[model samples]
Target: MSRLAYGGDYNPEQWPEEVWHEDVALMREAGVTMVSVGVFSWARLETAPGVHDFGWLDRLLDLLHAGGIRVALATPTVAPPAWFYAAHPEALPVTKEGVRYGFGSRGAICHSSAAYRQAAAGITEQLARRYGKHPAVALWHVHNEYGVPVNACYCEASGEEFRSWLRARYQTLDALNTAWGTAFWGQHYGDWAHIDAPRVTPTVGNPAQQLDYARFTDETLRGNFIAERDILHRLAPGVPVTTNFMTALSQCDSMDYWAWGREVDLVAQDHYLITDGRRTHVNLAMAADLTRSVAGGAPWLVLEHSTSGVNWQPRNPAKRPGEMARNSLGHVARGSEGAMFFQWRQSRQGAEKFHSAMLPHAGTANRVWREVVALGADIGALAGIAGSRTMADAAMVWDWQSWWAQNLEWRPTEDHDARERADSFYETLYDRHLTVDFAHPEADLSAYPLVVVPALYLATEAVGQNLRAYVEGGGTLVVSYFSGIVDEHDTVHPGAYPGALRDVLGLTVEEWSPLLRGERVRIEAADGSVLPADVWTEFVVPNVPRGAEPVWTYADGRAAAGPAITRHQLGRGAAWYISTRLAPEALDTVLAAAAADAGISPRDDLPRDVEVVRRTGEHGSYLFAINHTATEAKVPLGAAGTELLTGERAAGVLAVPPGAVRVVRAD
Candidate 1:
């Protein structure tokens, strides 16, 4: 029988030996088939210098196996014992402010430090050699989240290393100088020694230098991850290796997970609910979609989330009665195979004592534990979703490089946030109840019927070529303004506003008009109705290519009579460009038209608060309808099928209660 790995971070080492037995009993009661152990146990596993102790871990693993629980054994390299850091102080990470991180907390080691790397390799080798073939070991959990606290290291050692990395990338100082455009401020570098990691500069440092530093920081973390991964691959052959990632790309900007995703066996992420009294569940759906995309749309895992409220956020609100189950299964609806909380048992001491766990501070007699058990049963019943993948009809372009470069010192407007812009388009699609995936800028665009590129401020020639090919080959493309305007080096293209895509878009922007934060502008739609716009407005003289026309023009402003939105027809497909930020309602109107052109229909039968996602299984497609509101919602399944949870034949209308979910097998 298939089962979802149901338990979470288990720190038995922190408790007494007598408590392990009770924890096992509770684990069985909660239907936890697996638990991740030894994540923060590095200090305990290694008492002193090179001396190691595995007796405690050996007993714990054996006990878990006997309890019919599998193990996602973790390499405790995330937090090295204080002894190692004391022995090799040079391995400590330096902050942007130039202070070496103390050893009290986790994630204090420098990824670029050779001493840290050597010590990591030693511990990893020991763990793999000892537990690689253990019967209880099911998966290899690599070091915890890589760029949590110490993503960028700015010490002299990192400075030297960054110079070396640049030398290898550009191959010559002259090339590096040219790529950075060092002649602008008479700040040309004559040799490799002059370049640093962009640490504590008098003014805003060079955009190119900051961009490269972000890349280097990403690579360094990946290097540390790969060092441990290689050891496990050799010793624990066939056992999958993975590391948990934080919520979104913007949260950990330094790590390029698109690159890191290729290294892990399967993608896993930690996402906490945002209960700010808004449409917060949309954020959950977005995060899950991104994780599935990172896993190539395959089933992945939720390595860590809270059972109730997390202690970290400023005002962590406890989830309502049924909200937890809805949140967990929501991820499953988006191709997550498992949903595990941050911990198995609540901590009585330490930093995260209040972070919710399977068993809260109050034992299994409480509502949280009952909900945990019910959710476990629900997940186990739907094990048929294990190998399923969520198929999306549309994709939105997302890139960390573009996000990093878009935030450079000099820009048209400070309101241009790459993630927010991309999400604005995504929010419009979501309002239309259309499923979407997050696609890399240069990824294969053939699979998607419609591709939306929002605020792609720092586009590369290769990305532009890919997009052009996609449009010319019968694919619909929608690009926002400020895109295709610059090369990868943050250098603006010579001609047209969107230089690489000007010909395809069939418009030449003569000048850009940026608005202040609260300023508002209006655009005249094709219907002669005025619509609201903000942040940016471009004045374009339409050279109007053979098959292109201006769809929306500025009504009456400084940039009046210019194109605000345009549509073009290539060989067999079409492209649309929005030249300014629009209100959500106006943006939805624009996207609704583009979606129609692509033959994509919104699920109008379902309420907007009820999210409907489809995943294909061997039996058939499973339709999950999740209601995120506080009231009951009636949804039309559009097919005759059995609701998997209650085993009732749900034909047309399905009633989903507030904060609940319904999974139906489509007939």
Candidate 2:
């Protein structure tokens, strides 16, 4: 009813026909109505170059279609077979050290290799020609998980390409040298021929050039993704095609990935958590809400959630009991159309052999299966609620491209960490039970009344203009440290730390110092209440704007001291500035007070120890009041609340147990 699609990845490629049949029954029992097939079938598709095999796949699709299951077809180019690798040796990506990969894992291919492009386009054309009209095909999944460039490919194609990339970036060696400060390193290159990707930092050279190269490399890989996506678009015109994305990934920024949105139908992201508990859970909720917002509030798929512990990380801890269901339901409540497990079944071999699955090694009777079945049923019952409920009047902003620029900084100090700052900022905001949207720094700013930009280390001139306009147009803006210091190339704008923002902020930063990883600096607020800076510390000299008020003071004992935090009027809007990371108490004290300053308030009364978020849709708003604590709690409400998940109703305050959730519908 709500355009809810059920089902997730199913790899029949791994099992016998008999086992496949058994899975169908089990899938139906779990309320699954669709399957994702062909995630790793390049080997099956082309046994040799130009050869195509649809025998096993055709049969599998026919069987699933007969059984009334839809398919989210996969391109399955994770890793090409050894024959293709041997046939086109240039296809292998050369690492930064000049070593080529021999292939063993997924995401091993050189995305830009001529061989990869040729083979990928051919496979896509064939798949589209064969299955584009099939009722069984629902969507197309591009290469899995995308990639990370841990190893640099120093091969010839990449080497030649790097030169071209530099040429496009600087155009002239003089400009390149000036931007890179090449004179400082004596490593000045006479021409493009003298430039090489920074390795070992062999001599005094421009850190900016090297960093830009890293960025160029990042963009190059992103180009490959676009190329591959274009192939899928041509092959499958009507079908929605998407590759799974990692949110806030340091190496591969998903914002750059969004540049190819014309080829993408919907946004799908993976959510994994650390073991510290509620922090991880709340973080995932914010991410899901943000992902949906990026797709213009459409329910984005939770591409591949772990059924249990992830095997890839250095330390893999299995999720605690009830954690999986709680997490899954959390996504649904926040506008996720569907939930999918990375693996429905357990792997018997390879690196992921021990990763958790819905059906454990013990088969169908295990608790995991029971949990899966229970969640499946609950989700089925709430089918009409999926993609139905939406957020209400509150406005919160999160930016993506700005996030990339923040993390790309190769800081001399430890301050280049954007994810850490972003996560902490998110946590402090979410803890207050406020619903926030992750806005791309470059996106339109006029829609929302309140915008938050954290660790804005990178801000393009255009981005600065957008922020100024938003504020001038009466939109409230909240910004944090290391902001507006650099451009897209990670080069400083040369004047102020917040260069483009100086005029709007009405202040100039004289000097700032980096604080220790967890050290705190105390700052007193306007009312004499002190706040702590726990992330990065900066001293601010406020040329205080006329309508702006200094809210927080510097914890750093300095001769010339004033408030490190301030709020002021810029046009019809208000601008709030936070110089550094503040402790939870201080951060909340400021943000909550800031919301009050902007005349913004939560749409509904809140619960004690429960963070409630409401998403407004065309019909009405969906309210999610979640219990963050372990004890039973009651959330305050003025009107009646209907539980969309259980069809239960609550009058007055809604009572919920520890770590439990209630999705309610209220106008």
Model number with the top TM-score: 1
RMSD from true fold, candidate 2? 3.1
TM of each candidate vs. truth: 0.97, 0.91
Cα lDDT tens digits for candidate 2, 1-667 = 2335566678777787788878877887887766678888889888888888898888888878777777889887766777788888788777755667776766677655788777877777788789887878888887777664232456777667788887887789888877776776476779788777655444433557656655666676667656667766776678788777666333245434445333468777777765543466767776676666666666777777877787766678877666777778777777777777777778787777787877778898777888888778766766556556456333454445556444443463565466666666676667666666666666776777677776676677887888888889888888877678777656677686577677667666777777666566778765667766665556566664364467777746441266588776889888888877776667777778667756677434554457676656555666666676778878776568688657888777788778777777774
**Which portions of model 1 miss their true places by more than 4 Å?**
247-250, 545-547
Q: Name the regions of candidate 2 deviating beyond 4 angstroms.
A: 1-3, 148-152, 166-190, 203-205, 248-255, 260-262, 276-278, 386-389, 392-412, 516-520, 544-549, 555-560, 602-609, 618-620, 637-641
Per residue, candidate 1 scores C-alpha lDDT tens digits across 436-502 of 8988888998988899998787777788788888888888899998888888888888876788778
Native-to-model Cα distance after best TM-score fit, residue 260 in candidate 2, in Å: 4.5
